[model samples]
Target: MLEHNDEIRRVKISVRPLVEYVYSSGDIESGFRSVAALHEGTRIHQQVQRMYQEGDLKEVTLKTEMLYADILYQIEGRCDGLILLEDGWMVDEIKSTSSDICFMEEGYPVHWAQAQIYAYIVAKEQGLSQMKIQLTYIQVVSGEVKKFVKSVTFSELESFVWGILASYNPFASLRLDHIRRRDDSIRSMPFPFDSYREGQRKLAGAVYQTVKEGQKLFVKAPTGIGKTVSTLFPSVKAIGEGLLQQLFYLTARTTTRTAAEHALGMMQSKGLHLQAVTLTAKEKICFQEKVSCKKEDCPFADGYYDRINVGIMDMLSNETLMDRTVIEHYARKHQLCPFEFSLDAAYAADAVICDYNYVFDPRVSLKRLFEERKKKTVLLVDEAHNLVDRGREIFSATLGKAEFLELQRGYKGKNNRIHETSRVVNQYFITLKKECGEIKRKLWKELPEELINKLDLFVQEAEQELQGIGHGDAESRQLLLNTYFAAQHMIRISKLYDERYVTYAEVVRNGVSIRMFCMDPSFLLAQAGKGFRSTIFFSATLSPLQYYRDMLGAGEDDYSLSVASPFHREQLDVRIEPLSTRYRDRESTKGSLVRLLSKMVRERQGNYLIFFPSYQYLQDVYDHFSAENSDLATIVQGTGMTEEEREAFLASFRSDNPDTLVGFAVLGGIFSEGIDLQGDRLNGVAVVGVGLPQLGMERDLMKDYFNHIGKNGYDYAYVYPGMNKVQQAGGRLIRSEHDTGILMLVDDRFLQRQYQELLPEEWKE
Candidate 1:
């Protein structure tokens, strides 16, 4: 006979009554909630810090529970910090609130119950028979302190804990039921799609085989191949096969997350049962603008673990795809900290659809997933090429002397330790600035390891002081938080710090210092790629597969696939006019370029997009073309266009009784890739120049670097990137089998063998 699982056994007795009885709970928007509390807290804290002296404050440690377990049976329910106290054993829970705290009385049963749990744990840990537990509430505004205390024996505390547990059992039972069903569903689930495309099949087979064999596969499938579903479907099947347990669908942008969600929805519709979650960015998803994770500032963050287990159980049992809306609904229903709850839920999920940062970024990788990495996990990287740039930003750290100088001034008179640390960091930057000799930019062949080491020591001291404080002291807290993030960033980048990265310090102004830096992300990306069982990097414009594969760190053993465009070659009228539009030739060809654009618009009856190499070029053509054919409706790209404006720009193109709608946009900008202008809505694309990035120091350095590596320096630094932009822009013209459009290359470079060889077979003439 099969016995109940450990989770089932735990939930049976732990479910509490209060959670058991609630029905049709109101949904609290976590993002808004966090933002509100952050705003209020930041405002109040700023005022308090301005008026208060750091030396006047005393550090307090209110010992509550040594081991506190949630009444909910989830594995994440256990927490060590029950209740914290300031000096005089005054239990303090600092809360930042956007609303009145008058409704929360001193002896509220729930509040006391929570405090009692903490007290019980603290007493047991300290071997005390009785203790006075104080509930100190700090009003976010006015900095008012309200203290409530009650003396209770260990027996009373035990009774109170038991009561809370009894109130929580039903919700636990509901969760267990869902988990059992979800696991069962996953065990029996089949391939969701009725039939897979050829590219989808090949990619899926490779992913599954890789997971089974415990190796890596690098795939380059083109667009329209349903890469998301292809990758997800197999990972789900792997779950059923007991070869893998979790899948992380990582992407570069928020827009891509929806596609992952949609793919999961498709699987769910086919009777496949699994938990899939999309993690919104902390800043964007958080209800509060300035997020401080302590309970006193935000109720959602308060006693977060107490209700988290029930929240997780509730969500997993009822929903398959825990997208933002669904997660928010359940979080509100159970009064769980939505952000933390989402993270916890992700740990238990079968599939996690999130940004690449969640998995690859050292500063933000999910801690819980570390255990799942080896057993059964596969990473499906969408738009893998974007990882090249994204990885650099993630692995790079920047620090300014001005920030440390400001901090030194803020703490100089009172905190010797903080002041000394800040001074040390400030002086280092000063010395670095002096060495640069008034030049804003200077590169070091090697990283300044000694400087980094000294910074690390300072970070260690700051962290130690921060840990000692426990809670409160707004000014010190902010300083510590800033330093902590800085330290974390440095620590993350330190691992990848090498000769490939240029370490340069710049002087912004007198007494103001900054560091300009760059790290070769390829090696770091390769490190991230190693943890996954396999990765499929598919895009419409990965024309030069070797370039992408090399930069993405694909090994020789990794499989590569290139699918030919499904659309007929004849459908697109590809024409390359050998007319120079280079930077030097622009002035001479200005008239011809405008004439060419005007001619394309006149010849094309419907929607058309003309991509320029730079914003200046785009504006120049827009001005000339508008002056020549002012009557034609046109939208030119600006530095920043709101979502509504972008929608309006695309909406101007109509399929019925077509009128010429010309849009001028920079290559590789917002209008490129991800925007779908299927069929008649878009009929043609005219690309100007070679789309090379401006000739600058960075480009020159990259060229030199590649030259040393025995590769084509110009191609690596300029031509490849330019062509990538061109290919992506050209991809917009053909989206489907029936879609017919015209593609005109306005630059003479495309006619050259070097550039022409880089073109896709379908575009080669």
Candidate 2:
């Protein structure tokens, strides 16, 4: 037994975390986790466990304490199984692999280290001096097993434990020092701003209390409340109080991530010594033209793990603000992959600023996060209104027929197994398309298990070929890899298929595309956020709290808050044009909308934005408005604008501009909510419609699916979401107490009872 003391900290670590840190080294593989391989691994583990004798114990929990220098390292984990031998016991660790087992000579040293550690614990517990540890590798596709055994004396195991501790101590000590300083700085830190807005402290206090109590919070504070700072400050304070270990500042837009970074900077100015890292998308930050992670393809990925620790130590020691530029600099200097380096630093960071995908997307989430770690973490979701649709899109999966058909042709004579699997999957879609007849579309309430079965089999066969791929078949290899990803995703999602999901198949010009559309992502969202200490969902537009609460999976005990606007309602001059901007009425209303936009700008010579529901509407309105009012200078938001273009669009709304600038952009677009244009920079905003999503198969499917349950399908699928965007677009008008602007609601639907009730209290007033 080891005693706990203040002078020496106790590092309660696990064997897996220790070995994974010191041993696991490889190139950054660009692929999704194989669902088939994961399931097969579990099955193989069970098969091995079943073969254990009566005296053998499976999943034996093990723990041991050792003193290194002055720090007590307490490591605990469960071994796969413990087998009783005639003279000594053998510690067995089972593994499954897609690649051929014959290629593995003695297997990975990491596997031996893992089994050796478990053997040490069992020997220490039984007071034995000798132990035998075994590594069992079961080939996933072939079911062939390979075994390697090693005998070790107790002194050798003890030496091994000390060696492991020596390697981990530097990182552990650095973290210990940082936490001490971080807690001290947080304790003495004052609010970064000279004074808080009227509702700011209230929101901050609510966030702290929610995190302390380990409960989710849904907050609706009006714009200009300094929401980012308000939420982040409390979460940081919670970290200092030992109520939380990590904070994930999740954002829906790149612009909002900047807001979070700015907030952290402000806090740092107030003597906060916390480590925060911002994760940029791989495509945007990668130095290479294409995102190939092969060591040969990219120099940064070569020997990455060998240099990552040094790079992380240097980065954490010197910088508190590890944004993209800073991260990239260190990565380049140390020859480490920037994207992987950022993720590595994030695990050690006190806070991480990244897209919601890093935390919520099943396809791209950081899988290394365990439940124990999550229990000590809090999620501060920024611009949370965008997450509803984002959540749905993240959970859905689509597979096209063309990819499989091409695979069938590409591997016809090359590999019979691959060719046959591709043919079978392609034939299913062909029959599916014909079954739909003239409609050319079909919907199924349940997942087609028959299709899932074929995909599972195909995935198992595809993995075998993809293991030792060559450049000669680059085109075919890429196609198979892409198709494998698609199949695995569908197979994974099929397990979660419920009433909230619908399988839809549509015949397109190229081929048939099938999608497992997630209608309401609330359940999935809830599951993703389950083990976290707390999740603070704060936004300027979380109106009709009941609707959002239901859609976001808020529980009965989960807190809800609606903070009144600190700015006076009188500052916002709201008006209802009562004009039809519906799809059917858009042709006749186009001239009216353009005229209204022109007249609204002509009234006051300041910057203004007119938001339409779609890009086409914005273009049509812009063409007519520009042709009729040549004197008015206007900028139109184009589809797929580059980063510089987006910045230019926002820059066009300058406070120093002497003339009127009417900017036309789509509702729920890049500029609507995230951009900040304080004071006279932005004068007014006109929302063209209720912001209903265009009627489509997905939307209609969602409506029907929700209706089948006990909820109002139309409101869930359309009205509530549309109204939320309307509020987000309108939120641009009033940004500060000193700011005053006009908000014109162009559509007559705004006057309807359903839409009227959904508007925020301040907006309605």
Best by TM-score: 2
Supply candidate 1's per-residue lDDT for 749: 79
Residues 652-740 of candidate 1: C-alpha lDDT, one tens digit per residue = 76777346889899898878766768888899999897788789766776677778778777887788888888887888887766788
* TM-score per model over all chains: 0.75, 0.98
True-vs-predicted CA distance for residue 152, candidate 2, Å = 0.6
Tens-digit lDDT string for candidate 2 (1-765):
122336777778878878888885776664434454556777889999999998999988899888887778889988998999998799999988887788777968788888889998989889999999989988877789899888999999988977888998888878877888888899999999999999999999999999989999999999889999999999999888888889999998888899999999999988899999999998999988998787878988878888888899999888888999999999999988899999999989999999999989877888888777899999999878888889998889899889889889888888888999999999999999898778888878888898999998899888878776632287788788889988988888888898788888998774898899898999999998889889999888887788778878899999999999898889888999999988889899888888787778888889999999999888877888889999877899988999999999998999999889999999988888898999999999999999988888788878887788878999888888898889999999888889998999998888889999988777886
After TM-score superposition, the amount by which residue 734's alpha carbon in candidate 2 deviates from its true location, in angstroms, is: 1.0
Candidate 2 lDDT at 361 equals: 85
lDDT of each: 0.67, 0.87
Residue ranges of candidate 1 with Cα displaced over 4 Å:
1-195, 289-296, 464-480, 508-519, 642-658
TM-score of 1: 0.75
The ten-residue window of minimal lDDT in model 2 covers: 1-10
